[model samples]
Target: KLKDAHCAILVVKMKRTLIMFSFILLQLLLGNSLSPKHSSPKPNAEVTVMGFVYCDVCSNNSFTRHSYFMSGVEVRIVCRFKAASSRTNEMITFSANRTTNEFGLYKVAITSLDCADVDSLASSCQAKILSTTRNEKLVDRL
Candidate 1:
């Protein structure tokens, strides 16, 4: 009788373990299926570079400091494509003629040709913002 009881207990424990493992696997599978995979931009990404050009040191003269502020600060986006399959640098320029708005806002829509080149593209691009009125020091990132 004792041996039978031990056998039954072992069987129950085994069943419980199997059930727990199945539940965990189901949860993992569900989570994976629901989540979206990491893919490249679908050639329809509306890339915009918008920021305020403010003098960090000068807060006293708002009007005079930004009086000569103009738009179109020469923004260029270089899309680096350095994948395992690619040998050389496959950089694509999204916009060059585009410039910032009146309130210091710039928007550049990437072309389909540029987006379709690489499977995975860089999200944001490094830019050198240069203005004639401001000194070279002000020609920082955007």
Candidate 2:
């Protein structure tokens, strides 16, 4: 009789523990993540992004630092993300190029984000260099 009572008490304790654990899990999953720590901001929700492009003219020269603003380079907005299970990251790219004014200044308005990619748009927006008009060659010395 004592053994049966002990078993019943153990069962009751187990049931309460399971119920408490479930409630905690529900709160964590359903609660709004207002904390900045959990929030990955969808930044600069603007359609337009602007920047400059430069050529490392001295890419091969270790001792010299020489770079020039590239006038006709293609600058782009690129986004890369990968799921833990996926073999490779899916890259989404958007570009609208313009010939830089004499100053090597270029302004680009992202035309790619619309009905299809509105959600992931701001989260993955990044500026990148696409290509340059001048053929890149190894310069041995200045």
Candidate 3:
């Protein structure tokens, strides 16, 4: 009778351990599935440049309360990227013309296999207002 009792106690302990292990495994799977996933940009992915065109009404070289966004403005975007590796003497250039939307926002998409990472974009990209179709119909070059 003592041996039977011992076996019963061992069986109960085993069942408890199995239940705890199953709970822990279920928690791990659920946590992994519910967690937000962070994705890094893949190589050769398209890069977009976006900005707003605003008229500096005060001419202080900055936006003020009097300033307003200009729609239907023609903008030219140019980007030049050097080769990722210094061993290769390769340069990629991207140029596109885009018109500002009603919100005075312009977006240019550039896709190239030779594109450098985002860190190098600041030094390699340029955008300028090619023309403005406001009431004055002024054309400016930069």
Kindly list the per-residue Cα lDDT of model 3 for residues 1-142, writing each as its tens digit: 9999999999999999999999999999999999999788666766788878888766666767887778899898888776577677577777899998897888977776454545566577777887876654232222
Best by lDDT: 3
Per-model C-alpha RMSD: 10.2, 13.3, 7.5
The worst-scoring run of ten residues by lDDT in candidate 3 lies at 133-142
lDDT of 2 by residue, 17-81 (tens): 99999999888876746434655654643355555555556675343457666576555555433
**Model 3 spans with C-alpha error above 4 angstroms:** 1-43, 114-118, 135-142
Full candidate order by TM-score, most accurate first:
3, 1, 2
For each candidate, the alpha-carbon lDDT, in order, equals 0.54, 0.55, 0.76
The TM-score that candidate 2 achieves is 0.35
Tens digit per residue, CA lDDT, model 1, 34-139: 9998888555533444444434244453535444444545555454433323555545544454455565555555544433434455454555564535552333
RMSD of model 2, in Å?
13.3
Using Cα atoms with residue i matched to residue i, what is each candidate's TM-score against the true structure? 0.38, 0.35, 0.59
- Pairwise lDDT winner, candidates 1 and 2: 2
